[model samples]
Target: MQGPHPVAPPLVALTKRAMGGMRSVGGRLACLFGIVAALGACAVGPDFTRPEAPVPGSWQNAGDPRVSTQAAADSRWWKAFEDTSLDRLVELAYHQNLPLQVAGLRIVEARAQLGIASGMQYPQMQVAFGNANAVGLSENIAKIGGLPRNYFGYQVGLDAAWELDFWGKYKRGVQAEAAEMLATIADYYSAIVSLSAEIARTYVMIRTFEVLIDQANENVALQEKALEIAESRFRNGATSELDPTQAATLLESTRATIPRRQTALQQARNALSTLLGQSPDTIEPLLVGPKAIPKAPVTVAIDVPAAILRRRPDIRSAELYAAAQCARIGVAKADLYPSFSLAGTIGLDASTRGTASANLFSSGSMFYLAGPRINWAFLNYGRITNAVRVQDARFQQLLVGYRNTVLKAAQEVDDALVGFLNAQAAAAFEQNAVTSAQRSVELAISGYREGAVDYQRVLDAQRSLLQQQNDLTESSSSIATSLIALYKALGGGWELRQNDPVVPERTQNEMKERTDWDDMLGPSRPQEPKKNAAPAKH
Candidate 1:
């Protein structure tokens, strides 16, 4: 068969000369190495460039005094609430959340995959093999020659085949895996962002329920006093028995809400426990600080909208995934060209007749074969082309997905800003309502005591007070939670990882015990964002 290239004749002569002497083999290998080095310099396929995503130059709520366009002063945004308990919970969840640990493990897995891709730059196949077998010749075949009927054959050798990265297939593969590993790291930070916000939100819920229950209990006490007045008035013939009966009904109704609020509080605690990766029973002990809803600061530094591209891990992950897919297109395209490889085997072989033994290690018994090879799947209909198209399609999908992620991130920030601002406004009105309701209750109670008004007025005032108070509490909680949401949307909490490892040391130790992870599980920090780059334009 004809060789794949015009230079095959000279290369064939070189191979033959290599086989003639050991010194010549070394010189030929150096020549071959130089040839491969020169050819391997270029990589095939499209080089990755960050895709442009449109985002607003400024936040929609930038005009609001509470929203600042200055760069965020603190990435530990949970601390903005000035609640020590919330800060502790966030730290705990960062180290203990199961899902976050899984994300870190994925980084380790990606790193190993990268190592596999890198290894392909060298020999793709290598093996040391040995075998022994007894051979028996057929009588009919043996009769035609002066040969023994049976013999023993043995061989031991090292075999290796390295398909060089002449087409940049393996290089592209390494680039893809390297990008994937970075994406996984971003995923880990994304998990941290979620875990921190969830912990703060759940903690706020628990406090909200606590305050709501307190309000209900206070209303119950006020109603109990009103009932006493109604009962006395009825016994003294100053009012009808119907008044006391109505009073009793209102008291029981107010009392019923306490247990329900307690249930919600416990449920919130259970959710927080899960976020911390602890049993529900253990969560109560961690709830030791002041049982008050966290309060947001007067002003929050949200920075410009374009910063989201750099700050949000999901955005980074999406972009990196697209980049990785882009590299895959090159990998598939390389299959269209012929693959070049070098294969060789070196071994000792010997055969022994029935009563005789052979020395397999003798220099004369050793043999080796070495040559360059070429492979072309020229007959594959459209498989390789379609594969390239498939990767390109996926790359396009990820690009679109990345753009969508940016839009959604901007939406979240805008939504949270509106929610936070409006909830604060509503809370002001609710507070006023609570104050008016409290004054009305006092006036009604005084009037009923003096027989200047009906017991119904007192009941109405008390009901209004309870409802207004609960509404105020809910609105306050909303303010804090909305702030948490805004911080989350801004992707602030991931900066906590600057001082922490992606995986907890305890988890790393446990994983090491289960498998030989080598340096993959070691302390590794999230990569810092590139500086001074032009922000993505909206």
Candidate 2:
């Protein structure tokens, strides 16, 4: 550009002085922040130690060849069925399920809470503000001879204030928040595990209902044939009207089951659709064709009972919640100590006597200040101690809850294992009964056709075969569904979400459009979980 603009000597001197003042203050503030941060490293109160896990060495129901001490290999337990459709459904549910999405949102909320707690360790008051005002003193206003009647003033300043963590109150608060965030993550895993199991169970029920419907229709056809034969025999005076009436009754009874099973199938579809986070009709295309009931693998790994402490998301979540509560005890204890703070303000202020004028950077207007403040709640010890006791009590309750959760998880696994094993046995026996009944029905129908036996025998054999087949189908479905329940109890499928984004893309976009979050919604770095101490090996 052209020659440098000439500087007024007074303004130049003021600028140099102001720069020096700013340099001096900035240097002190930087050193102060560093010192405070270093001193803050010494946190008061009890440090956390993970509680020991209470569980058995082996599962009570793991005697079967299908169940063993080895842990499950596939975290995607649903994939063990080798069902393409089921795999797709689980994938869709992971992405689209609203409850799961809500769980993810909770994780985001917990992360924000942690951020807020961490921020408390830093300056609580930070702002740069400027104010301009005009003042006119009335004749009645208190005044002195040296004071001007009217004046204009302007102030530009930045102030910062920090409540120091002298007793580690803020650090303990941050610890609690971090634990809560981890608990939220565990809750998210729990949601996924439950959601996947539900989807598989519902699908199995639908398929079982479809099979039942087909069997009922087949029974209806057999009954119709018997009715036709009885009517022919009665018309030819070879049988009584009672025979035809009985046949008709049986055929109508079999037909009634069709509508019931169809209704059930539709309801199952609706439930599965809900799990996929869509309307009932949306799942029709996926479920329209005939599909076999999903079957479980012959052998399933049960893992050691203590593994529940790690594998079960509910158990993990409960323990993490207890840990968070444990930290609250420290937070409350920190309150018993004195509080410390540092407050400061650096500013440029100016005033004029005539129409309008300001000399903001002038030495006479520049100002800076800093000081320490202390507050001790010496008289509130009763309230503080009671509050701390309350937190400790809550932490103990959570510990008990965590233990209870472990027991429940073990019970569920036992129940599922026994149910699945017995169901498979029942299915096998029912299949044998079905085979024998089928042969009897064939013989009786042939004997009646040849006039070697009465139609009552035919009817009995047909009814027995139909019932046996239905029972077998039901048992088969139970085995698959029970296995799903067992997998859920084992806490499978949550690991699939590792490294996945917590918030859905659509929700993130909507949130961004709604407000300025200052990138608060960004993904958080994954934290290594605190492990519970295991029992000593014998």
**Top lDDT hit:** 1
Clashes of each: 2, 0
Q: How far is candidate 2 from the true structure (C-alpha RMSD, Å)?
A: 5.1
> Worst ten-residue run, lDDT, model 1?
528-537
In candidate 2, position 373 carries an lDDT of 67
Candidate 2 local lDDT, 1-538, one digit each (tens) = 2676565575566656765866866686677667866787677666655566567677666777767666564687888888888888889998999999899889888877877887887889998778988988898988765668889888876789989886678877877887888888889999989999999999899889988988898888877888888898899888789888988988898899899989999999999988999998789777744467887887777667777777998987887788778778878988888777888876778888644465776677777777676788989949999999999999888888887888889889889989988898899899999999989988987887777889899889988989999999999999999899989998989988877777888898998788765554554444532322111123
Candidate 2's displacement at residue 530, Å, is 7.5
Q: How far in Å is the alpha carbon of 372 misplaced in model 2?
A: 1.3
- lDDT values for all models: 0.84, 0.81
Please give, for residues 111-207, the per-residue lDDT of candidate 1 as tens digits. Answer: 7888898798899888877899999878666353455788889887668999888878888888788888888888888988888889999999999
Clashing pairs in 1: 54-538, 55-538
Regions of model 2 farther than 4 Å from truth? 1-39, 288-290, 353-358, 450-452, 515-524, 527-538
After superposing candidate 1, which stretches have Cα over 4 Å from the reference? 1-37, 143-146, 354-356, 525-538
